[model samples]
Target: MASGKPIDEKVRSEIITKIRDEGMTVTEASNRYDVGKTAIYTWMRDGVVNSTSSLILENNRLKKENEQLYNLLGRATVELKKSKR
Candidate 1:
């Protein structure tokens, strides 16, 4: 397959499943399917390729937002302590 050409979602899912459940190597699958190895690895790591589920995407977004909020809170707390000292 051409690198620029998009593969069907179902096919991509199958490929990922094969790599995960069948113990196939990233390189082997990439070579067999003509897909980029990085893309295959990403699919395996993420559990879904080109994710269409809004919930998954929303969860990821929320996680990042939560991290930022925590970091901001920490910084504010440190500033408050320093100002009080």
Candidate 2:
């Protein structure tokens, strides 16, 4: 930090990503970066990171899988119709 304050923005972001995105605990991230737990908690309080990204990725992946399955079902339906005729 420029002054006797918290960590820099880049460092804070990295800490957030390491903890939230990489699934590391606050304690783990603190120890890995040698930062204090209080600082991590403060950044979290300011909404520096959240669990929404993980959920969004999971939802998008599931949506893609669902679309593929729907396409497969449609193709199977068409094949069945042709076989019956």
- lDDT per residue for candidate 1 within 1-85, as digits (tens), equals 4477887888788787777789888788888988988777766667666563555688999999999999999999999999999
TM-score of every candidate relative to the true structure: 0.51, 0.48
What is the C-alpha lDDT profile of model 2 across 1-85, one tens digit per residue? 1234657677888888788778999888877877888788887776663444455678999999999999999999999999999
Candidate 1 pairs with clashing backbones: none
Poorest stretch of ten by lDDT in candidate 1: 47-56
CA RMSD, predictions in order: 7.8, 5.4
Predicted model with the maximum TM-score: 1
Each model's lDDT: 0.79, 0.78
